[model samples]
Target: MSTENAAVNFSELVNRNKQTLARLKESPRLLLHRRDGEDLVLTTAARAEQDQTVVSAATRMLASLARREPGGMELLLGILPDVFPWVRFLPEPDLHAFTVELVDTMRAADSLGNSASVAQLLITWQHTAEVHSDPELLAALTRDHAEDYGPATNPRDVA
Candidate 1:
């Protein structure tokens, strides 16, 4: 499916995903925007489950792409925008760890001599505009996914 970036109401978007998982696959690049003041509040359990689902699904998709072409690292830059509505909602350390791995992968891909990864790069900017606008979504993502984030691709000891 083609990537689309259109202005949308939060409520409408949620309703759009009511037939989720199956539907989410069809709109992998569909970015959502909220009409001002439309809040999407989730109970803690609901938030945790959704967070887990998003992380799992996004990670699986990214990993597959990475495996298909190592340049998939360039693709990771889109993770925040593509999988998530709010970048700020993402936990910093987890995101950071992921980013570190992404960069390493990108560098490895470069060594393998790729000219570029256009589709991967394109979806990134397409999704960036919608990030950082929703606190509720961010809270949910951070709370549930933080502890589960690692076994980092490269684990390290802190001083």
Candidate 2:
């Protein structure tokens, strides 16, 4: 075994165990944040429901990744309808705008090849939206993303 071959083998071993390497290969733009005494995997439904801070942190990380990656926007946009299913039941301007922005960000992220981060963000957003029922907000979101939302029609008529 020559020095060069030995060095190459060592490098490969190091790369295999690194989390960043796995992320880069599996989902390059996805951001993973470490919390004190927190497990990366949520084993049960109760644990997932009880972990608000972890969920919020994950959301922020996704938002940050979308901001950093332009292609992630499309994925973000795709998430709106799925996250806010009750958008057809309420009337609120601010929530509507927020949902629109989130969708736009996803679209942008997707364009930039940040689909993984967008997916992660969507998961977090859906979970959060489910826990906090804002009828108006949900309705507004549904209205804003109606065109690209497949079966869901936009409540307002636009000419």
Candidate 2: which stretches are off by over 4 Å? 1-94, 134-159
Q: Clashing residue pairs, candidate 1?
A: 89-138
For each candidate in turn, the TM-score is: 0.23, 0.26
lDDT per residue for candidate 2 within 30-143, as digits (tens), equals 232334443232123443444544555565667766566776555554465566664433235534555556656655664554556657755665555554476666567657
Estimate, for each residue in 73-113, the C-alpha lDDT of model 1 and write its tens digit.
45665565566444444455645555555544555444443
Candidate 1 lDDT for residue 43: 27
Quantify how close model 1 is to the true structure by its C-alpha RMSD in Å. 17.4
lDDT of 1 at 55: 51
lDDT of each: 0.49, 0.49
Query: Residue 83 deviation, candidate 1, in Å?
Result: 21
- Superposed by TM-score, candidate 1 places the C-alpha of residue 50 at a distance from the truth, in angstroms, of 46
